[model samples]
Target: MVLISWYLMLPPPVFPPVKDASGDYKMNTTAPISQWIKFKTFKSEDSCKARLKKMPAFYKCIASYDTALKPAATPSTSTVSGAAGSHMQ
Candidate 1:
């Protein structure tokens, strides 16, 4: 069986507050929602969630989905999909 890797997504820096469709103001993030970076890697979704629980308060994490592994015969594939966006120092 094939295995899919998960990512601990890190949110980009916040800028000014922006209004959404509902007319509620929210902190404007540096990157767009789709472009938010994937910070760390995990073997599975459950493991990613586990680490997020213990992560520092400063960081925000989101689980990554590997759509590449899925049965997508289409030719168009996102370069950033199913892969880590940033490297650790």
Candidate 2:
């Protein structure tokens, strides 16, 4: 039936939480396996490991930056002079 074929194409309703070789769940297991993006596909896990060994190790980290800062308050020189004159009087 068409329904059966469609169901087969759909991603599994439940996915057992799994982790990739890197031990990061978000990379390949957090989402539907079909929806997960692959950086590179290899014929086998051994080939992938071999290729990874040849490549330099790099860490991927997330960072956030905020550019908003409060402006500095400045006192005018005239105000100081006026206050000094008042005190002298």
Candidate 3:
């Protein structure tokens, strides 16, 4: 599942921006969550929630983001490294 598009790069506003605003200045020109590059890959999860309900509302559909991003998934095996010196005395 993947249907992401809400990153907001910035540097292209000012189309009557904010004087009588309807929508602009996306949280003050977003782009700083490590330069968020939103994904977009759909082959399932009901076609990524059926195109995430016609987009908008920070479109999102995650299946663990299609895997392979393990920053941390700990189960606390004593934090793993060496593991009590590999179970030796």
Index of the highest-TM-score prediction: 1
Which numbered prediction scores highest in lDDT against the true structure? 1
In lDDT terms, how accurate is model 2? Answer: 0.38
How far does residue 23 in candidate 1 sit from its true spot (Å)?
Answer: 28
Task: Compose the digit string of candidate 2's lDDT tens values, residues 1-89.
Answer: 22110111112222466665787442222333343223454544455565556543431111112111122456989999999999998
Q: Which parts of model 2 have CA positions greater than 4 angstroms off?
A: 1-29, 51-89
Clashes of each: 0, 0, 0
For model 1, the local distance difference test gives 0.58
Q: Write the per-residue lDDT of candidate 1 for residues 1-89, one digit (tens) a residue.
A: 66567777655554565666887554334444455566788887787888888975544444445442234355434544533344322
Clashes of 1: 0
Task: By lDDT, rank the candidates, best first.
Answer: 1, 3, 2
Assess the local accuracy of residue 79 in candidate 3 as a C-alpha lDDT between 0 and 100.
58
Question: Considering TM-score, which of the candidate structures 1 and 2 is the better prediction for this target?
Answer: 1
What is the lDDT of every predicted structure here? 0.58, 0.38, 0.47
lDDT of 3 by residue, 15-34 (tens): 45554365435432343233
Query: Model 1, poorest ten-residue lDDT window?
Result: 80-89
**Considering lDDT, which of the candidate structures 2 and 3 is the better prediction for this target?**
3
List residue ranges in candidate 3 displaced over 4 A: 1-21, 24-44, 68-89
Which pairs of residues collide in candidate 1? none
